[model samples]
Target: MMAQWHPIAPGEPLRAGDQGPRIAQLRKLLQMFGDYNGHPGPVTANNNNPERFDAGLQLAVESYQRRHGMAVTGVADKATLKELERPPVDLARQLEVNAKRWDKLPDKPGKRYILVNVPDFRLHLIEQHRVVLSMKTVVGKSSKRTPDMTSKVVSVVFNPTWTVPRSILLTDLLPKARNNPEAMHRRGYRVVKYGTNTTTPISDKSIQSAARGKATLRQISGPGNTLGRVKFIVPNKQAIFLHDTQAQSLFEHHHRAFSHGCIRLQQPEELAYALLGPQGWDRTRVAQATTGDESITIKVANPPKLFIAYFTAWVDGLGKVHFRPDIYHRDN
Candidate 1:
């Protein structure tokens, strides 16, 4: 059955009234994924208008979207295309590969656990087997793939300063800083001596020296901060954690693998409140901590355990099958 399937690579969404070979491609994909029961019907029929997008096909698309954790718009959108464009053989391979991953999971994850499935670009807060909270996440780019690990969100830092990582300095910002030192300062950056917090303000001359690798730079906490207003410190060797992002607009895109190595949350405040509320932190206090220039780090005495998993395919507790694109090509 998989051998008879072909890939569907539409450049745009296919709605209810669309027609052409793309529609047939859509139907065949939906059929291949078990979304449509009229397999041998539409696929095998010799009708002259087999490429028409009828209402039944639209319903099938919605079913596929809903099961795959996507917006059920009844249109073949990019997220849907990312899944359907894959040949059936690859998807089957994902199931077999992910099954081994699923087996490694502990039978009892805990009363509460944070699950960040990298390929799915989503974070779910599970409490007693119920998904009490879920949100969109921007994960590491392909070049710096987010690693799978176990850790605890040990602290929540409010109004955190962005200490520019050394790799990012050389690879991303050094050229731009050399181009315009003043603009770099205007962008909330300060050239400071490496490994020490210099209290005095730095000069433009220092910016050039910093760009030339004489020193390091850090972004002050202010408007448009790189770490946004908050940072969740999940302790692991990789130094990866979940945090708010200044580029909140990135959450609106369907494909959200854009971070360097951390997971950027769409609704970080919600997660923050969830984590700190039990520790007697109210929303008013939380909001206040996030404001102002001073950085505050609150230690979590009982932090929630975090599990970052990489699964291209898995079945949700609700029995809905979910498959994601092999963005890092790990599904061998």
Candidate 2:
């Protein structure tokens, strides 16, 4: 005989006092996540069938949503159900991969510091034992390939000048220069000419012809700058740092790894404040430090420890495993 599906048996006018099978299951689920106390008062229509889907259950759902960066509507809708029903094996696999990656990080202590997880596309500002602030971030594209590494932030550059990378100059800008030299200059790129034996300043028209013929050329910075208003200088071999990007629209997306090789922050100023707070440096002082003619290095009184880790799976504080999409395909 096949098992029969039943209506859980409270009747059409089920009240708060009713104890149905559905309500029992809901309570079990909440307990799994350490959220049993969320039920609050008696289950009623005012709180959306509390006996079956009570306030406690809703709060549990909201907690899950917040951790995963989802809308915390407190109702288990289609998306919520899908997330909740994700296979445990998959979550375990992600956690394992990220844990291995975390094992390869450096252990250094400072007063405060910023850490960015490229694959996860998030940033954390850690101060002492607590995570002071967290924000969404955009990383480099697969082609540009942002590398995972660590370094000390030496200084911040405001209204900074950008030195175009050779790869971009050869692949992207040179082609455009061949077509219109003026376009490069109008957009703040300084063009130069290189001969068989020496190099000299060149006209836009000349650059265009040379680019058309596949000659090597480069551009210097101005208005349509890739690095927007400011840049955080971190001394590392990868030449990567936290910089402002003109492409602010990318932040609206859930997955935001779309840079050349640097981590673009959603809230660079707030991060600046957090990092500099222990040093007794305010916004005005930090801004002044970056605006001078030369790059300045302001050593923190006590540097903060940073962990740029990639974890797709992990047990939360409640001991329930949380899973995230492996956007970088690092596990595979």
Best by TM-score: 1
- Quantify all predictions' global Cα lDDT against the true fold: 0.81, 0.63
Candidate 1: the clashing residue pairs are none
Task: Show where candidate 2 strays beyond 4 Å.
Answer: 1-38, 45-57, 71-79, 106-111, 192-224, 276-280, 287-307, 315-321
Query: Worst ten-residue run, lDDT, model 1?
Result: 39-48
lDDT of 2 by residue, 1-332 (tens): 01221223222322234445656654555465455565567755665444465556667767766655566677655565556554445555667887787678656545466777776688887667467899888888877777766666766565566655667776887777667767666666654344432232447565665555534443333335677656777777777778777788999887676788788888876676666666787888766654433534445444454455566665655576556666667778
lDDT of 1 by residue, 195-249 (tens): 6787233466775666677677788986668999889998777778788898989
Note the clash tally of each candidate.
Answer: 0, 12
Candidate that would win on lDDT: 1
